[model samples]
Target chain A: MNISHAAKASGLPVKTVRYYADIGLVAPAGRTEAGYRSYDAASVRRLAFIRRAREFGFSIEESRELIGLYQNDARSSADVKKLAAKRLEQIEQKQRELQVLHDELKHLVRACRGDNRPDCPIIDYLG
Target chain B: MNISHAAKASGLPVKTVRYYADIGLVAPAGRTEAGYRSYDAASVRRLAFIRRAREFGFSIEESRELIGLYQNDARSSADVKKLAAKRLEQIEQKQRELQVLHDELKHLVRACRGDNRPDCPIIDYLG
Candidate 1:
């Protein structure tokens, strides 16, 4: 199939398909004589796997590693678990940081007068 | 002061100071006789403000609005409150989205066997 057909089959945008090709993440199985991208069934499966990993909030690099493990029949499940654990740790760290920002911002918003006058604690605190 | 001095005083890297200048978020006060970037105390203050806003997870655009509000003494406190409320809403939305991803990924991780064997449910599900 063509790049468009591959993208459609994989439920990804054409632009994303091109980007994945450009990034060498999930390039087409072959190129046509006319220099157009070609996708075999296996390539489309890889694309779908990438799409699923991305939907689960995996970064490109993480998706690449996961795809690597998927492609290798001899790959251990431990490696995949390690990557997932690392991703979870990162998400947890961000959650903690965002929670701090949310709490502080909520406090400042509560203290602000939010009136027509220029006396706002929010601005003052930020300033 | 030179850009380096201003950056040091503001606790920002010189490259970041140059980036701020390039993006016009916090340009230097003037250019020296040799066309070198020069920063006054006031410009340093704005850079500091931008740095702080970035630390709090504000986008460069949001920091620009905040800096504008900070510079305008006649700005109504209500306007500041509005911006803060908008930011709070965005942060809340992200937190919820991250929470969903976290929960789903955690569930998958828990279901994975993560052993030396190649029979991994995570890869099976993702695939």
Candidate 2:
């Protein structure tokens, strides 16, 4: 199928399809004689898989690694598990950092008087 | 002071100081006759405030709004509270979303056997 058809079937935008191709993330299976990008069913599946990985918050480089693992027939499950573990660890760290920010902001918000006065702890904290 | 001096005093990068000036987020006090960007102490303070705001995960636009409020002496604390509350709500929503992703990924990781076999539940899920 054409790039448009592949994008539609994969539930991704046409621009994203082109970008994946440009970045060598997911190349089309073939190209038409007229020089337009053409994709096979397998290509579309890869595209969909990448989309799912991104939805799971994998960075583009991580998605590329995942794709590599997906394509390697000799790949061990341990490698995949390791990658997922690293991503999970990063997410947990991020959650902790965000929790700190949330607590700090919450405290400042509670201290501020939401009235006609110009005195605001939030502003003072940022300032 | 020069742009470099302002950036050094504010603990921000020189590139970031130039970018803030270009975006009108923080303008220099004046320009030297030689066309160099000149900044005052107040500008350095504002730059520091903006840097702190960004460190709090506020978007550039949000930082701009906060700076505006900071500059306005007659501004009511209610407006600052509203903005901070909105940011807090967004952070909570992001936390929830990240939690969901973390849980889902964790479940998939647990189901996978980290062995030499190519059979991976993580790959199967993405595929």
Candidate 3:
């Protein structure tokens, strides 16, 4: 299939697919006589894997590491487990930060009377 | 006070303070004869405000808009309210995305045996 077909199958934009190729994330299986990229089922699977990894919020570098491990038959499951644990820790920290912001914003919003007068606790807190 | 003093007071790095100034997020109150930036209490407050807004996940442009609303006496509290509501919505969306990723990662980790054998469910899922 062509790049567009690969993109559609992988649920990534054609631009992103090209960028992935540029960054060595997914190299096309071959090229057509017209210099366009060609892909097979294996290439499509690789693209899908990359897309799934990205959706899970893995950084490009982390995705690369995962892909490398995926390709390496000698790779240990412990290594992947370690990476997933680290990602979970990062996500938990972000969740805590977001919860704090959510609580603070909810309080500010609740305190705001939303009256016609200019006196606003939201502005007061922000200012 | 000097930029370093302002950074120390505002809990921001000197490089970040300079970046904020370059992006028009905060302008120095004045400059000394030696070409060093000078600040007053007001500038420090502005930096603090910017830092706090950033901590709340507001983009630089959103922070600028908040600062603009803050500076404009004629600005209605409704305008600020709207901006805050939008930010809350954005944060909520991010929280949802992170939650999904977290759940998926948790499931994958739980399924992994982490054995010495090369046959791994984690690799199976990734591959």
Worst 10 residues of 3 chain A by lDDT: A112-121
- lDDT (Cα, tens digit) per residue for candidate 3, span B1-127: 9999999999999999998888878999999999898889999999998888888788999999988877777877777777888898888898998898888888888887776655667667766
Candidate 2 off by > 4 Å: none
Decreasing lDDT order of the candidates: 2, 1, 3
Clash counts for the predictions, in order: 0, 0, 0
TM-score of 1: 0.94
Expressed as tens digits, the lDDT of each residue in B2-117 for candidate 1 is 98899999999999999989999998999989999998989998998888888878899999999998999898888888888888998999999999989988987898788888
C-alpha local distance difference test of each model: 0.90, 0.95, 0.86
- Give the Å error, residue B125, model 3: 3.1
Instruction: Give candidate 1 misplaced runs (Cα > 4 Å).
Output: none
Q: Could you give the candidate ranking by DockQ, starting with the highest? A: 2, 1, 3
Q: Write the per-residue lDDT of candidate 1 for residues A16-93, one digit (tens) a residue.
A: 999999999998999989999999999999999999999888899999999999999998888888888888998999
RMSD of each: 1.5, 1.6, 1.9
| Per-model TM-score versus the true fold | 0.94, 0.94, 0.91
Top candidate by lDDT: 2
